[model samples]
Target: MSNESSVAAEQGTAPAAGASHNHNPSPNHTVSKDTRRRVVTASFIGNFVEWFDYAVYGYLAGVISTVFFPESDRQTALLATFGVFAISFFVRPLGGFIWGHIGDRLGRKQALSLSIVLMSVATFCIALIPGYATIGVMAPILLLLVRVVQGFSAAGEYAGASAFLVEYATANRRGLYAAVVPASTAAGLLLGSLLAALLSSVLTAEQLNEWGWRLPFLLAAPMGLIGRYIRTKLEDTPAFRELAEKDDGVKAPALAMFRTYRKQLIIATGAVLLNAVGFYVILSYMPTYLSEELGFGATESFLATTIALASYIGFIFLTGIASDKFGRKRMLITASVLFILLTVPAFMLLDTRNFLVIVLVQILLGGMLTLNDGTLPSFLAELFPTKVRYTGFAVSFNLSNALFGGTAPFMATLLIGMTASKLAPGWYLVAAAVVSLIAVLFAAETSKKPLLQD
Candidate 1:
C-alpha cells in the first residue's frame, strides 16, 4: 500500500483499539475524521491568537512609543518601547513552567484556555491604558506589567498547541498537522501587519500616535474569546489521556525533563535558534531597517511588509504541507543549508531600491524561515516521551527564543550602528543557521515513529 493508504488503514484501526485503552472522559477523543478536524482547527486558532497579540507590538512599535512614552525624545521613547518588547521575553520561561506543568498534569485543553485568557486580558489592558500625559510615569510601567503577562501566556501557547495536535493526529499526518500551528503564527503576523498598514493608511500619523494603535490590541480580545471557546470544547489528546489513566504523567515535569531529557533539551534548543532569530529578523526588524536605513517612509515600510507578510502566510502553509510528504528532516536540512547560502545575497537584494527585487527577497526569505518552523513542533515533540513532552518542549523552545529570537532586532540595530554596515546581521544569521544545520544533521528523525509508542 502507498503511504496514504497505509496511514488511512492505521488511523482506522488504531483509534478503535486505542480508544478502549485510553481513559479520556470525552468520547470524541478517538482519531476519527471529525476529531482530527476539531483538533487542527482548535490548535490553529489558539496559536493564531497568541501570535497575533505578540506581533502587533512590533508592527505598531512607533505608535506605541508615541502614546505611552510621550514625554521622552522620540528616539529615546522608541528605544524604551523596544526595550519593553525585549523585557517581555524574560517572563516566557515562567509562563512556560506554569503552563507546561499544568498541561502535563491536567490536560492540553485546559492549559491552552488559560493561556489565551491571560493573553487576551493583557492585550486588552494595553488597549485601554491611558497615555503618559494622562497617567504620568505609570503608563509605561503599567505597559511593562501587561507585557509580562502577555509573555507569560505566550510561553505555553505554542508547545501546548503543538502537543495537542500531535497527540491527536495520526502518525502519518504528524508533520502536516504540526505545521498548522506555525502556519497560524504566520497568519497572525499577516493579520497584525495588515491591520497596522490599514490604520496607517487611513489615519494621520499624529492621530495614530494618539489613539489608532489601540484598535489592533483591542481587536485581540474577540479573537481570544473565540479561541477560548474552541479550546475549551476540545477533548484532551490521546497520549495525555493514556498517560493519565496509567498515572504515568510526571508530577514535576520540568524537574524530570532536566534530569532525564537534558540532551534532547539541548538539541531542541539549538534547533530553534536559527528559526527564532531569522523570524524576528525578517518579521520584526525589517520595518525598522527599511524606514531607518533605506530612507523609506513609515507608510511605505508598512505597505512593503504587509505584502511580504501575505506571501509569508502562503509559503508557511506550502512548506508545512510539503514537509509531510518529503519528510521533516530532509525539508529542514534543505531550508537551513539554503538559508546559510542565501543570507548574504538575500540581504544585499533587500538593500536595493527596486521594489520588485525587495518583494522577491522578502518572499524567499520568509519561505526559508518557514521551512524549519513548519516542521519544528513535530521534530521537538517527538524528541521526548509524553511524560515530560510539554515541559521539555516549552523550556527548550522558549529559552532559545528569549536568548536569541527576542534580541535579534535589538542586536542587529546595535551591530549595524557600530559597524556602519547594513548587512552585519548576515553574520549572525549564518552562525545560527550553521548551528541548526549541525543539530538537524545529528538528531534522530522521528517522522516515521508512533508519538507515544516509546
Candidate 2:
C-alpha cells in the first residue's frame, strides 16, 4: 500500500470522522501499529523515570532538608534543599547542548539511551551519599554533584521524546500520542507522591529523615534501566531517518539552529514557559508548598497532589484530542486565562486548611495545566524543521525550563521567604500564564501542517 493508504488504514477513518485520521497537509508517511507502539513505549518510559526523580526530590524536600542541612533554621534548611533542587535545572542547558548535539549529529536513540543511563547512575549515586551528620559538608556537595549529572541528562529527555513522537505519529494524531509524554510525567509524580505519603504515614519522622528517604532514590536505578531498555528497541524517528539517508545532518546543529531559526526559537521558548513553570509549581512544588508553608501534614499534602495529578492524567488525552479537533491556540489560551483568573483564588482556597477544599482547588489548577501540558510537546516539536528539531527544542525548552521551570520551587520559597506570604507562588503562576497568553496570541496554529516542512 502507498503511504496515504497506510495512514488511512492505521487511522481507520477519514479526518473529519475520526480525530486520529490523517490530517497532514503533505504526504508524510507513518509506520504500522506495532512500530508506533514501540515508538511510544520507548518515548514514555524515559520521561517516566526522569520525572519520578523530580517528584521524589520535590516531595521529600522537608525530610531531605532536615537530614542534609540540620545545622540551619527551618526556613534556611528548606531553602538550602530547594537550592539543590533548583541547581539541577541550571545544568539542563549544558545537558541539552551535549544531548542535542548527539541527537542532531548521531541519532535520537543514542542520545536517549545515554541520557537515561546517566540519569539513573546519578540517582543511584545520590542515594548512596552520606548525610550531613555522617560526612559533614561533603554530603550536600556530593548531592549537588549528582543532581547536576541528572539535570544534564534530563535536558534532552522530553524534547527528544517529543520529537520522536511527533516524527513517528500520523499527522492528525500527534497531539494524542504526545499526550503520553506529560501523562507519563504525571504518573511519575503520582508514584512519587504516593510513595512519599506511604513512607511518611508509616515511619516516624526521625526514621524517615535518617533512612527512609533513600528508598525512592535507590529505585531510580532499575527504573532508568527499564527506560533505557525500551528506548534501545526502537530506531530513530522517520524525520531523522530521512535526514540521515540524505546525509543532511547539520555541521554544528546548535549554532546552525540559532543562526537559522532564532525567531522561531524565541516564540517556542515563550510558549514553553507556561508548561515548564505551571507544571513545576503545581505538581512538583505543591507538596512542599502545602506541608511546609500551609501547615498541612505530609499525608494531607501528598493526598491532595496525588488526587489532582490523577485527575490531570485523565484529562490530558481528552484535551489532546480537543486540540486536534479544535485548535492549539484555543486550548492554550483558555488554560492561560483560567490560570490568570483563578490562581490567586485557588491559592486562597489552599490556605483554608480543609482537606476537601484543598483537593478541589488542586483539581481546578490541574485541569488548567493539563490543557497546556497536553498541547505543549507537539506544538513545540512542530515549530522547527527536522534537521534542527531536537536542538531547537532542547535549547529553547531547557533554557526556559531551567531558568523558570526548574527554579520554580526555589523561586516560590524565596518569594514566600522574602514576603512572608504563602500565596506568593500563585502570583508567579499568573506571570507565567500572561507570558504564555501573549505567545499563543503570536503563535500560528500548528495542528495540520507537516513538521518536516515547517
Candidate 3:
C-alpha cells in the first residue's frame, strides 16, 4: 500500500471524515507496532533517568547547600548552591552542538547511548564526593565539576528523545507519541519528590545533610546503565537511517542549521522560553520556593510539588491528544496566555501558606504547564527537516534552557532578595509567557503536517 493509504488505515475514520493527509511517503508510516512500543519505552526510560537526577538535585538543594558550601549565612549558602546549578547550564549550548552533530551525522541512538553513560557516571560521582567539612573548598569544586558534566550530557536528551519518538511515530499520531517524553520527565520528578519527601520526614537535618542526599545520586549509576542498555539495543531512528542512506549525512549539522534554518532556530529558541521558565519555576523550583521563601515545612513543600507532579503527568497526555486534534500553536498559545493571566494570582495563593491551598495552586500551575510541555516535543520535531532536525531541536532547546530555564531558581531567589517582592517569580514567569506567546504566534502550525524530509 502507498504511504497515504497506510496513514489512512492507521488513523481509520478520522482521515476519512475530511482530515488532511500529507502526500509524501514518510518512513514513519512503516514502523512496526512492536518497534514503536520499544521506541516509546527507550525514549521514555532514558529521559526518565536523566531528569530524575535533576529532580533530586533541585528538590534537595537546601541540604546540598550546607553539605558543599563553606559555613556561611544560610541564604548565602543556598545562593552558592543555586549558583553551581546555573553555572553548569552554561555548558549546555556547547553540548548541544557536539551532540547534535553526533545525532545528526552518526545516529540518535549513538548520541543517546553515550550521553546517558556520561550523565549517570557524573551523577554517581556526586554520591562519593566528600563534604565541606572533609575537603573544605575542594568539596564545592568537585560538585561544580560533576554538575558541568551533567549539564553537558543532558543537552542532547530531550531533543534526541523527541526526535526518536517523532521519527518513529505514525504521521497522524506524532503528538500523542511525543507526549511520552514530557510524561516520562514528570514521572522522574514525581519519584524524586516522593523520595525527597520521605527522606525529609524521617531523617534528621544533620543526617540528611551528612548522608541522605547521597542516596538518590547513587541510584543514578544503575539507572543510567539500564537506560543506556535499552537505548543501545534499539536501532537508530528511521528518519536518521533514511538520511544516512540518502548521502553520508550532514558533515556539519550546526553550521548547516545556522545557514539554512536560522529562522526556525530563532522561533524554536524563543518558543522554548515559556517552557524553560515554567518547568524550572513551576515544577523544579517550587519546593524550594515554598519552603525557603514561604517558610513552609520541608516535607509539606515537597508534598505540594509531589501532588502537582502527579496531576501534571495525567494532564500531559491529554494535552498531547488535544494538540493532535486541534493544533500545536493553539495549545501553546493557550498555555502562554493562561500563565500571563494566572501566574501572579497563583503565587499570591501560595503566600497564603495554607497547605491545602498551596497544593491546589501548584496543581493549577502544573496543569497550565502541561499544554506547553506536552506539545513542545512534537512542535519542535516538526520545525526542521530530517537533515537538521536533531541539531535544530537540540541547539534551540538547550540555548533557551541554558539562558533561562536552568537559571530560573537562581533568578527567582535573587529577584525576591533584590526586589523584596515575593511575587517576583510570578512576574518573571509572566514575562517569559509574553515572550513565548509572541514567538509562537509567528510559528507555523505543524500538527497535521508530515514530518519534513530532505
Give the clash count for each candidate.
0, 0, 0
Tell how far residue 193 is off in model 1, in angstroms: 0.5
TM-score of each: 0.91, 0.93, 0.94
- In model 1, the runs with Cα more than 4 Å from the true position are 1-29, 70-75
| Order of the predicted models by lDDT, top scorer first | 3, 2, 1
- Give candidate 3 misplaced runs (Cα > 4 Å): 1-29
Instruction: Report the error of model 1 at residue 428, Å.
Output: 2.2
lDDT of 1: 0.80
As for candidate 1, its clashing pairs are none
Candidate achieving higher TM-score, 1 or 2: 2
Residue-level lDDT of model 2, residues 1-454, one tens digit each, is 5344333333222222323222232245456799999888778778999878766888898888977776868889988998998888898888778888899889888888888888888888877999999988998999899888889988988888888888888878989988889998898899999999999999999889888999999998889889888888887877777677668678788887776667667777888888889999999899989988988989989999999999999999899898888877789999889999999999999998999999999998999998899998888887666777788889889999989998898899999989998889999999999998887786666776555422
- Model 3 Cα shift for residue 127 (angstroms): 0.6
Model 3 alpha-carbon miss at residue 353, Å: 0.6
Cα RMSD for predicted model 1: 5.2
* lDDT tens digits, residue span 1-454, model 1: 4332343243322222322322233453467898889888888888999899988998888788778886666556667887888888888877788888998999888899999999998998889999888988899999999998988899999898888888877777777788888888878988888888789889998889888999999988899999999988877888888777767666799987776567778878889899888988888778777787777777778777778877777777777677667877798898889989999888888788677787778878888888888889888877767777788789888988888888787777777878888898887888889998887776666676655421
RMSD of 2: 6.1
